[model samples]
Target: MNNRIKKIENNVQDKNSAAWKKLCDYIDRVAEDGSEEFSPANELGYELFSQIYTLPETISKLKKVKKVSLYGSKLKRIPPEIGQMESLENFVPYTSYSLHWFPYEITECKNLKDSTVSTRALYGNYKNRMSFPDLSQNPVRYSGETVNCSVCRKKMTYDETNQLWISLWVGTDVLPLLANICSEHCKNALPKPPENYIQKAHKGSSTLPQPPDENESFELQIKEYEREQNTINNP
Candidate 1:
């Protein structure tokens, strides 16, 4: 396997390991006081967790944490268990380059108020416009590889799922996240993307709206400025 896939597999293994459980126990104790700050990169050694692609599902154990930082971790995904962090308010995952998306379940945190992300690395980012993975078709099941529904977490075969992609502002950045759902019920449970985005789940392809070229974007900005000037003068 390539280094990228290897890192992801390693992260998955770490999530299930005893060491990860120990880490979770530490965080859980700190979370109860709601005063201590947590920076996994610093506590765990940046070089160690930086290669991790996903956080453990034990993240839900931080029920009283008010803020969490995950700066510079090379994460590819976050577990939906994060939605269970009832006291979470601030989320920082700045510079996590490989994390292209987030789980829609994050909206379950009613107290979550702010977030920071590396927008440039995101799929379909406004400035970069990187294309998202083509998710209209279900991913093929590899022999012995397990596939689970993103929402329900139930074991499923590739043929038993439907794939959808949506972009939403989970905290402060709009992230393009993918969901492999087992049924339409789970798909409907997704919250809407932030206002002024594509406004619907879509398959990744050239058909999606393209960002304007530099010249075109500049001209559009000039026209917008002129229109605003006219409105100000007349009003």
Candidate 2:
């Protein structure tokens, strides 16, 4: 079997990086002007854009954006603050292979109805059976000042919270979400995962069981992705 699924590090935005400043500036413009769409790649240019490994917590300021297009981003994770983008509707992070999971808080975007994602790269995606990060071993971190319970929004600390993975419907896709809860009652309050998923919120570990993957359906897709990565790296 392949190696145990490792936890992908959350590369926090470097405040001193040019990419951060550019992205912050773009967000400022969007917040003041209000827009139906936001695409940082086009705004930051390829040079600075490639440096973006994750978005800022300031993403919550985009209160009026109806769509977010992060096609081909290098992001490893999205901040939980994205849940505050109440007007968000279409989320397009289609080719962002490094983005393995989302914050459970994303479900709070009541208007999000459509999304484009790289299913094979996502943790717990039915197409790949990618292993989720073993939260039991890896420490949980939050983008906010304090970790809050994903269910009831109760304030919590590292010593008081339990972090787990849950595959839930976000827009039209069922994506793996990281949930930080203060108590078992909050965990029990989590919405059930859809059919074909793990069926419950679970602390991810290598020993954690999962449904068998249909390798035949995704072999070519995986190979193609590898080829593209090879070309980008070798060229």
Candidate 3:
């Protein structure tokens, strides 16, 4: 298995474990109380690091939660069902090193306001660049295998879909989100990415514009500083 999948598998939690029970309890509490702030990481005695993947279907039940924190968890992906949380306002997943991207369905949360993500760990992050998975141009349906469109959740065949990647700020932190769409129409329906990011979705490849070289950037800064010092002395 590749390193990414390996990391995910390593963090998978057993459903019957004490940690899972604690997570369940927390979820129930949030659901019952309709609490505005939910931070599973802060729960006492709950070792969340071992639970790499979240039960997205279970999380869909947190309809009344406004803020969700998964800081430092080992999550690999967010469930597309997160869009169903109509009341969700803020999200914090800072330092989740294994999470690479988000599902397009998160856009369904109209009230979402802020997000905090670990940008360095994301696919195609500006600071420590990483490559994104190449999406298939012609998605085909395999007998007995089904994949839903990331945007509409409609059943889609491999031949009928298109895949693309985009970076957007769901709350405060910018996240690289992936879209598996049924048609060009769904692709076009995606919202614009956050300011200072790529303006549109593009295929993941080396052809994408490269970020500025760190060494070159540092040299330019030094040059500017030297020019400023020279001007000060002459004046």
Best by TM-score: 2
RMSD, each candidate, Å?
A: 6.2, 9.7, 5.5
CA deviation > 4 Å runs, candidate 2? 1-4, 143-145, 216-235
Residue range 64-113, candidate 3, lDDT tens digits: 98888888887767767688888899888888877877777787889998
TM-score of 1: 0.71
Worst lDDT 10-window in candidate 2: 1-10
Q: If both were scored by lDDT, which would come out higher, candidate 2 or candidate 3? A: 2
Deviation in angstroms for 55 in model 3? Answer: 3.7
Error of model 1, residue 186, in angstroms: 4.4
Which structure is stronger by TM-score: 1 or 3? 3
Give a tens-digit lDDT track for model 1, residues 1-235: 0011111122233556554555566576666656435677676676566546666676777777778888887776777677788888898988887777776667677887898988877766666566665554323222234556777778787678776778877767777776668888888877777654567776665456745534556789999999999999999
Candidate 2 structure quality by residue, lDDT tens digits, 1-235: 1224856674356779878898989988988898878899999987898888878888899999999999999888888889999999999999998888899999999999999999988777777687877887786675555788888888877778899899999999999999988988898899989887898999887667787566744676788899999999999
In model 1, residue pairs whose N, Cα or C atoms come closer than 3 Å (at least 3 residues apart or on different chains), thus clashing, are: none
* Cα lDDT computed for each candidate against the true fold: 0.68, 0.85, 0.69
Model 3 error, position 235 (Å)? 20
Best by lDDT: 2
**TM-score for all models, in order of appearance:** 0.71, 0.87, 0.72
